[model samples]
Target: MPFSSSSSSSSSSSSPDSKYNLTSAIRAQTQFLTHAYTSHNLVIASYMKNMDNQPPRHEGSTFGHRVIHCDREEADRRLWNDYFSEYPKYSEAMFRRRFRMSRNLFIRIANVVKGHDNYFVQRNDRIGRLGLSTLQKVTAAFRVLAYGIPADEYIQIGESTTIESLKRFCRAIVDVFGERYLRAPDANDVARLLQIGEKRGFLGMLGSLDCMHWTWKNCPTAWAGQYAGRSREPTIILEVVADYDFWIWHAHFGMPGSNTGINVLEGSYLFSNLANGIAPPCHYVIQGQQYHTGYYLADGIYPKWSTLVQTIHEPRGPKKKLFAMMQEACRKDVERAFGVLQSRFAIVKGPTRFWDKCVLHDMMSSCIIMHTMIIEDERDEQADIQGWKEAPTPEVDIARDENIIFQEFLARHRQIKDKEAHYALCNALIEHLWE
Candidate 1:
């Protein structure tokens, strides 16, 4: 009774019975329950928080967990500027003069490549990034032709473009510019080249021909057969014939070195049956075999053919001096052409550093074609020079002199015994006689 009496008095002091009925009392009780539950949850959360604050107990410590803090945007901008400043510049006029082509020519060519609708579909979209003008693109090509630098380096120096963009630009230029510039010599062009050679005292010389080995890097294992014999390095052998003016008359490139020189020569349309129509008359006998006419000039490496003139290795007394002089003079054209080509394109002065042979080949071929175009354009610009006007007569006289020697040799050989008999006599004379 005492406990009941205390409870009734506590309930009356709290609030009126109507003011707090079963529904209201139940709600008040629920509020207290939610608060108690929340407090209990807070205590559990505090316990877990304390556990998490302790160091992880594992096999090893996380000593190398680094937090990178750098200004990424600023670093990227700096790299872009650094790449942009690598190229050298010349006055627009100087560029035009050196290339010997009008600015319009390059612009027209660039527009054609840039406007190619199909190029837009590429995934990486390199063509869109080439910000260079037409003139700049042409100049970049010149850098490749003249400097022989890797296309990436050329583009960097020639245009304010990225290496990747330059690669695309170079490929596009080669496609468009090569078609526009690197034309095969026609009959008329061959005749003109011969005329220029004659003017330069190369008698009966259709073109000043030479062979060079362009060193390659990281050649495929399958291409071991094509490496240069002496160097034991991968290379692409190129045979080119240029005029006295250094305008390329014929180009035979892309043949593997594993192929014989004779085979390569034969495969070249420049040396094949097509040449017979364009080659000039010869004044020298080859292998002691006399032919009616036609000849090419070759170095000691080539096999003697009636269609080729080679300097005699051994001649008696005074004739030796003359032959040496003639050989020296004839070989100079090729040397000069190579020298000029290398001087302008510094990249090809030695072995390429690229790891792919195909890329290297394309780079080299494009440079060569571009160089020829430059020479052709330069020659056209200087067509009226007095040096060329007075050049052919002296060359014709030398041809006559060579013809006289040929006629004399023919007459003497005819006077000897039968052809087989004469051949045996000559072999016997050389076989036993040792210096």
Candidate 2:
């Protein structure tokens, strides 16, 4: 345990003790290296696993989250479904069937109008930089008829179309439909309708006619006197006539009330025909005056003319009661036509807010034309006129059968009866006319 320095030195130099210290130092260095190596390997393995699990970064997904860009095809399909659903009665296929028109038809018609040489020449300019497809224009025009949306909304729906294009499309459709459908009755057509009415027991009646008023939003300050009425608003007047079949024969619009009814009537070609002795022959004596016989059913607001049948008043007595009833019945055709028109094209249901009188006139005329077309399209004549000509009995069941059919017609059009006023007026008019 206690040795001399020399002996300790000699033993340290040659004995295993010397080697033990050297081996220990070597082992310490090796152990440290092994621990560092194992730790580094573990760290590298963990980093590699994380890198394997991580997703590749995308620009859209990295910051704002993944965005779904809908394909144009899908967008169009959805929009079409939405548009189709708005009219439950018409499926996409049914609409195609009933209209008997295609995208190509719309395009062709649009091309005729849009590429019109006359229009370009008149404008003295080339086509506008922005243009809609013929199909788009037709669709826009029909959208106005079908939905009556505002111009701005229509433009938005039409995507790239401008308000001017929408207006032009409307005008084009009107012009086309007017030429094809709103044509004035030829002598033959007039004669045919008259004969049909006569066969239905409506004697001497050319047509049932009436007038309606639409309020105007922007009355010209200088022309207020000509346009303003007791309603304290400026308004435009529209006179429309329908035959017994509820087919519109004529429409006269844009007359100011400052013009008397007689004046307005005189301005129409319809009235000109009567003045020129072109009316049919069927004579009825009125107040001791015998006139060439043709009758027009009108409202109480109209003056009694030899040619115009008015509801009987109280002074006309018992015979007048029958006349009033007949007059009311005939005049009902015009009212029913108006109701159907207003119901189908809701744009005319309320006061028109158009700022321009000319535009208003076109809008009203277009509405009338469109209304007539729809009536022609939708009416079931066989059902409407069935058994209307049976002779009236003392105890005629006016409230049964045909009368029920008439009521159903009104109901189908979502019309309500003005029961109290209508019956009273009927009784009074009948009493007067019969007397």
Candidate 3:
């Protein structure tokens, strides 16, 4: 009975209702297979395709560059006559004022930069017309840096050429002069600085440490809040250690403006050497107690770290007040360095126009390098700089060999962070400065 009744049951199961459900499922599967991508996925695929199809900016922009054939040869002749000639229109004094360096220094820099990059060499463009002369290019770059002017100040140089020249100049300066100028204090330097600090009543002080903010006018919208400081302006922070002279011994740039001195210090490796026992020996006697690390005079915002000396707040007595006065005065060395740097190179003084933080970093580094170069070149003229520049540099190193003592390193690190030492040093300084 079951076998004979199966035909009717089977036929009923295959009726139109069942047939319709099967057909519906098939149609949904077909639609999904045909159009699997959602709008968001489609948008992403199209963007990737576009990016793949387009040439890069640096290469693509040159495809139809409008070559401006200015009187570059005449410009070169005039530049040589005014500066490099035996007899010239501008005197050596004017050269220093305008170039922000001596004539000989500028020539040496130009020659070195030309060797590194042939773009500085006088050459003909595609059509065989003489392009911007080396002097023209260098001068244009200097003018922009010194004055913070738009790139098109010179009729001979187009805006693009001027901008390119300036960028190349910054890169070359950083590459060529960075090592000599941007170096941390070596052993000889440490010794000299220690002696100078002793003379100034700072005993073991390396220099003054401080932070400066450079406004970022073209900060990305997403980063505006992160880069804005107390002034509510988008900016970047620079942490520098500067000596009594405007020589910046150490620099760390590109911190978001919202950061304080502590944040920048965390981001920098300034204390890594001290932590590892590779820092230059900064031995000094304070109240007959021997200390191992040099200290920087920092502001009150910084933490009470042993290596940072902050002025006493609300000093009640003549001794405390005088100590505070002296501490604050010495701490202004970094601030004064910042002022002199900005005064010399107006580009960093004004709001930054470049969007790339790396470019800004390079620009800042190069400016500091050139500033030091100028300082060294004219050290003879700087009355107070005579002693430190002449300090004998013996080849002394903290890490005598590669084998390190982990225990001693840890002990040194602990000493660096010891708040008790910080207080003790402050008291010793108060007494020392009083006498």
Candidate 4:
């Protein structure tokens, strides 16, 4: 530690003490800086390596990452108790109100779509998350359709998942029941419809044809100009044909709201099959004149096509007034169907929240299909309640009426668009009602 005077005197070649000490100090500082720099680089390299090996910032948060695995047998048992049991958690009325289908029908639907809707096993190690039960998924879809609620709030399902469930549900219903419920009339159907029409005093009425407008809540602003009608609000028209039992037989949708009932009728396929000679044989007699074409009771806005029977705007006498009254009353079949459809599924009653036109179309189609299904189901129950029986045949051969003759079904169907037939039929109908 002492100044080494002897050593400095012996080392003359080392140069002056001041310069030598300064040079030594600079070398020490340089070594220290180099060591510090190396340590800093090593730390930074370790951090970069760790970052490279790390997962993405959004990992484990997305749907693909968050796996929901379910035990199939267990889930089935739970759903069976909760929904399908003889003594289920909810009553039949409650089930009907919530899902808009009877418990049995709901179970049938679930069975049909089970394979398509089942979630895959997600975790091999342990149960990662329980995939939503079939009941949960169905109830979620129903809530969206019936209450217009954000299904995300219920069952903690994501909005996207809820939307997917709804899409699948509608698609499945259409696939499973569309043919049976939403079908053209067959021979039996024609017979029943004609029988009902004759009883209602409309000799050849097929059904009522009308148009309903569903407000588009989420309609895009760009299309507002085209969709907005006289109501000055965005709407989509549904051209529907409904019978006496509120069973909708035909539905043509997706027309913009700027059109009238006449516009829809002109473009509709109401008489397409008749025009092509493929319509079912319709036979009826009014005022001793036989006709081969059936007609639909429509409002005054409809065209004077023979298939369309519009009531007179201004009736002159008691007979015309009675005819008008009956026509208007019968025409409300479609209006009632629309009302029941909206009342059953509030999704159609309220403005639709979906933006896609196709989704809206599918939604309406599904609702109509379901409506017909419910009507058919109720009709069976009504038949049971009424204890309807086939009338006993009476003994024939006592009286042979000269006016009785066997008539054959016409091979060539009449064109339903003849205006002359329309007037003739109207006059006959008026005379019949007058007598």
Q: Per-candidate TM vs. native?
A: 0.55, 0.57, 0.80, 0.75
Candidate 3 deviation (Cα RMSD):
9.4
Top model number, TM-score = 3
The lDDT leader among the candidates is 3
What is the per-residue lDDT of model 2 for residues 22-103, given as tens digits with 9 covering 90 to 100? 9999999999999999999999999999988988544453575554432433433443454334544446466544333333
Model 2 deviation from native, Cα RMSD in Å: 23.5
Clash tally, candidates in order: 11, 16, 0, 0
Worst 10 residues of 2 by lDDT: 116-125
Q: What are the per-residue Cα lDDT tens digits for candidate 1 across 288-312?
A: 5443333355676665554444565
Worst 10 residues of 4 by lDDT: 404-413
lDDT for 378 in candidate 3 is 84
Better of 3 and 4 by lDDT: 3
Our tally of clashes for model 1 stands at 11
Model 4 C-alpha lDDT per residue in residues 347-433, reported as the tens digit of each score: 888888789998887788888887887787767544312332333332234224433311111222244556787888888888887
CA lDDT of each prediction against the hidden true structure: 0.54, 0.57, 0.86, 0.77
Cα displacement (angstroms), candidate 1, residue 206, comes to 1.2
Give the TM-score ranking, best first: 3, 4, 2, 1
RMSD of each: 18.0, 23.5, 9.4, 13.1
